[model samples]
Target: WVDAPNLASRILSMTQKRIAHDWMHCYQYAPVLIETFVETPRFPGTCYKAANWTWLGTTKGVGRLGNSHKPTLPQKNIWVYPLKKRFRQILCSNVQ
Candidate 1:
């Protein structure tokens, strides 16, 4: 349920209570690993990050074809950490 930025905050807050009760309770701590399926260019995840979520990695490019094989849909990307970990890593990769 990736919502637009404008809608994320409102939706998160609105669902906080229930989320904490229903979802959060699943683990002892408030859950640290947060994975999501991101295929669409438009997704509202900042709000989730702010709430303490982690992004893993993104899916491969588009579908692929092979001999007598069906093409597969693009994988769902995963963004971890409230700070967009993957992006930061790329930015700092060349730093000394």
Candidate 2:
């Protein structure tokens, strides 16, 4: 876990650089966005917020195999990081 102040921003910057320079080349495609979840009650997603990630919402307390009518897991907060400035436009575009 990162404890140092402002370290999350540095780490996020390095990760984005690596993804653009290395991962994109290897995968042959640039990702528009990245998403992650933080377990609520245990974490407040402070690092993700510090790194400029958006808090989309919270997930329903349902596991992958569980039914929506009966949630069987802890709810988590959803966070997203958009790589592109026009990520929403790119994601919604139908051009291939």
Question: In candidate 1, which residue pairs get closer than 3 Å at backbone N, Cα or C atoms, i.e. clash?
Answer: 54-80, 54-81, 55-79, 55-80, 55-81, 56-80, 57-78
lDDT of 2 by residue, 1-96 (tens): 856867778888788767755756898888888889999979999989988899999988888876566767788999999888999899989867
lDDT of 1 by residue, 72-94 (tens): 56556575442233655655778
Query: Which parts of model 1 have CA positions greater than 4 angstroms off?
Result: 1-5, 24-32, 41-53, 61-71, 80-96
Query: How badly does each model clash, as a count of residue pairs?
Result: 7, 0
Cα TM-score of candidate 2: 0.81
Best-performing candidate as measured by TM-score: 2
Worst 10 residues of 2 by lDDT: 16-25
Backbone clashes in model 2, listed as residue pairs: none
